[model samples]
Target chain A: MFLITNEPLSVTEVEAVVADPGAGALVTFTGVVRDNNLGKSVHYLEYEGHPPMAEKAMAQIGDEVTARWPGARVAMAHRLGRLDIGEASVIISVSTPHRADAFAACQYAIDRLKEIVPVWKKEVWEGGEYWIEGSTAAS
Target chain B: MITVQVQLFAAYREAVGARQVPFDVPQGATVLDVWQQLQATYPKLRTPRPVAAINDAYATLDTVVQPGDLIAYLPPVSGGRSLIPSPSGEG
Candidate 1:
């Protein structure tokens, strides 16, 4: 399962989507909004995404994970709109036959999501705001 | 001449002050050509080489754009967890 929503992200919901009886290990990663960036106090974050393209990119990441780690199931979700400090903005869950594969695949999923997914976040600071540039435009 | 719609996001959207832009260009114009035209029209578009997307897919500057194409000018992504530093040694 891959999605982009304006609702709050839930790790349990993401984990359930990737749960498999055959899998002995499960790993999940959640991205939370931080209060400060580069020594500047942040009020909140606003995320925007191209839903169709972002979903396609996320599904491709899941496919890549399954190809690399056999028997692995992956699910991911990214939140849109304004998110306050400590709010969960993104969640990824992976289940595999072993813990090693689960850990690696989960990490890879988030990394690939950031690299290819068409999601952008704007950091609203005390006085001003700027869009955070994570990866290069071509990445 | 061909007419294409340009979708702007993030800073690009803010710069243009509109979500979509329409351009009429020569039939053989490429994606880069549309970008050049945009720069000439909107001087506030400071990013000389913004990312381009055709029909919701990532596209190159040299990609040929067809009539009625939905071209998106995307800004850089900044929402990944990698930007955050970990308290422990492991990131």
Candidate 2:
């Protein structure tokens, strides 16, 4: 499933979907907004998604993941609009017959999304704000 | 002839004075190529645009660009721990 929401994400819901007895492994990744950056204190964060296109892009990514690992269960959810600190920004869960594939696919989802998803985020620091888009430097 | 459509988000949108921009890309233009040309014209547009997408996902230069293509130029996003109200929404 592909979705963009302004509401907070529920990890329990995500876990429930990927929970399958046939699956030997399950992985979940949550992206959250954090306070303080560089030298600035972030008051909040804003995310915007080109919904229609984002969904299409996500589907393509899903297709790629499946092709890479057969029988992999993949799901992704991304947050939109302004968010408070510590809120979930993105959630990805992957389940597979083996733990290895589940781990690999879960990571792949997060990595690919950073590169291709048409989502933009802006940071509002205490007293100031700036819009920055791109993947986390390390990821 | 392939017409390319470009959309600016956040600061780029405000900087360019609008949210959506469409242009006819000369046949066989890559997303990166369009980015270079647009940057050349909109001098204020800065570098290290943390991310980019064609049709809403991370796109590559090898991705063939055609007329009516849509590209998004995004400034590097600031990742903080919280969500706030959109400043633009403020009256």
Candidate 3:
């Protein structure tokens, strides 16, 4: 269920794809837009992505999780375009036979998604806006 | 010469003022060549090197560019709290 959409994301939708009868636990992670960043009051965020490549990267992450945790199933969805504060921007669901595996796999998915996904975000504030590059180093 | 489509996003898109552009490069030119040419054309593209993908797959800068290929130069990335956490746990 790796997906990229301009519409709002739903955790239930993503979780349904990873539902497994053998699974005892399902862990989900939702990344939401915040109102403040770097001490500036954020107005909103605009997400842009290469849809095909982004989904490819996400599916690759799922494959990694499956290989790392043999019984785990993973599904993810990421939303694009203008998103206001508190809106869900991304969701990752992982189901596994044990709670530990489900939790670990779910965290790993989000971390890898941030690292490899071909998506970018722009933070717009009251007076200005800046593209977030996810690097702390000066650009 | 070969022509490839260069896709830019985020800062790269704003810097170049175009979402995508068609570029011409000599045969056997690598992705690095395309980056250099873009830098020469748009000095505002300040990032020295960014991750590149060829035809929707991750590629090294040295990877050869193919005619009609869709090449994307990604700025860092977004989402997640922080890319690097402080070792000392103090800001």
Distance (Å) between predicted and true CA of B51, model 1? 2.1
Off by over 4 Å in 2: A134-139, B1-6, B21-43, B46-91
Candidates sorted on DockQ, descending: 3, 1, 2
What's the lDDT for residue A40 in model 1? 81
For A21-62, candidate 3 gives per-residue lDDT tens digits of 999999999999989887788899999999998898788888
Q: Per-candidate DockQ versus the true complex? A: 0.31, 0.16, 0.36
lDDT of each: 0.84, 0.72, 0.86
Residue lDDT tens for model 1, A17-93: 98899999999999888898777888998998888888987888888889889999999999999999999989999
What TM-score does the predicted chain A of each candidate obtain versus native chain A? 0.95, 0.91, 0.96
- What tens digits encode model 3's per-residue C-alpha lDDT throughout B1-91? 9999999988999999999999999999999999999999999988776778888777888999889999998887765433222233222
What are the per-residue Cα lDDT tens digits for candidate 2 across B1-91? 5678888877777667777877666677777777777777776677633256676555655577866667876654433211221223110
Candidate 3: list runs displaced more than 4 Å.
Answer: A137-139, B79-91
Q: Which candidate leads in lDDT?
A: 3
Report the number of clashing residue pairs per model. Answer: 1, 24, 0
Q: How close is candidate 3 to the true structure, as a TM-score?
A: 0.89
Compute each candidate's TM-score over C-alphas. Answer: 0.89, 0.68, 0.89
